[model samples]
Target: MPSMIEVRAPLEIKVDPQGGWELAFWVLDSFNYATPFRAMLIEIAEALAQHPIRSVSLPDYIVDEDFVEGTLLFNGSSLRVYYEHALSYLTLANDDRGVLTIVAQRVQSRIALI
Candidate 1:
């Protein structure tokens, strides 16, 4: 039997006119297992869904010459969420939601798991 999956809504949901919602949906759908990655994605979605436009303060860090702007929070021991702009694609570790969605769509092609 397949394991059960839990779904929860975040406090807010903000999507850019360009493609933020689409990107977020794709990222949520890419989970194959209930691993940390999947949980992290769900947590992010829930947080966004609940607090859509609200800003959550996170740590700061410098990247290259320009500072990577946004709140920073630890997703896990190895992962970090670097949220830059609201309604725009946010970066999770090395992959951004938009990029991840694109990759997931490309790999699955005609079908989507989530």
Candidate 2:
């Protein structure tokens, strides 16, 4: 059996238009230092492609009501990636349609910034 949690696109991609690709580059650039991070990112992308919601679990940090601030998770660990640094925010909603809408709005806002 697979993990109960499913991995989706990096949350940053939904909030930041350029964030996804930019993150890809950063991961590549910092391959030496960010190897684990990069690997986790790739794993997330792959999991999303295969099983968007059934492949990974949400980071505990996101579950905190006080932690309105978002961060990145990789290597089964949480890594702080500031909102300003993100190209987009990846939202997970109870409803699939809601998730798409939230992600879309964030992407639009990110595009507007450019």
Candidate 3:
């Protein structure tokens, strides 16, 4: 099996009349973390707009519990990311409501077995 598979996520962008563009608020909403983490999320968003993402996964030996949920401040409200599994799936929650979610569709790493 491959180490990772490319995945594409449709992003929302807004273009003003003057030819300036910016990501929708919802896209920024999920990136309420430290500078590096936020920058990484922004990079992912920008990359998704161009093509599929292929190299954004943890090593196979990493376990789910090794990942930790993240919380941060956004517009005076609390935003959080819940890691369903290490870099494979996550949910972005804002002030108790889920605003965004991401799932790596073809990832081979195992989170659990039933």
- The number of the candidate with the highest lDDT is 1
**Ranking of candidates on lDDT, top first:** 1, 3, 2
- Per-residue lDDT of 30-66 in model 3, one digit per residue for the tens? 3333213333333443333322233233333332243
| Model 2 Cα lDDT, one tens digit per residue, 1-113 | 22221222323323333232222112222113312332343344344342324334434432212212333433233323322113222233222234434433433322212
Q: Estimate the lDDT of model 3.
A: 0.31
Q: Which prediction has the highest TM-score against the true structure?
A: 3
Q: lDDT of candidate 1?
A: 0.32
TM-score of 3: 0.29
Candidates 1 and 3, the one with greater TM-score: 3
Q: What is the C-alpha lDDT of each candidate?
A: 0.32, 0.30, 0.31
RMSD of 2: 15.1
lDDT of 1 at 31: 25
TM-scores, one per candidate: 0.21, 0.20, 0.29
Estimate, for each residue in 26-92, the C-alpha lDDT of model 1 and write its tens digit: 2232223322333334345344332312323443333321212333232321223333222222343
Model 2: runs farther than 4 Å from truth?
1-35, 50-114
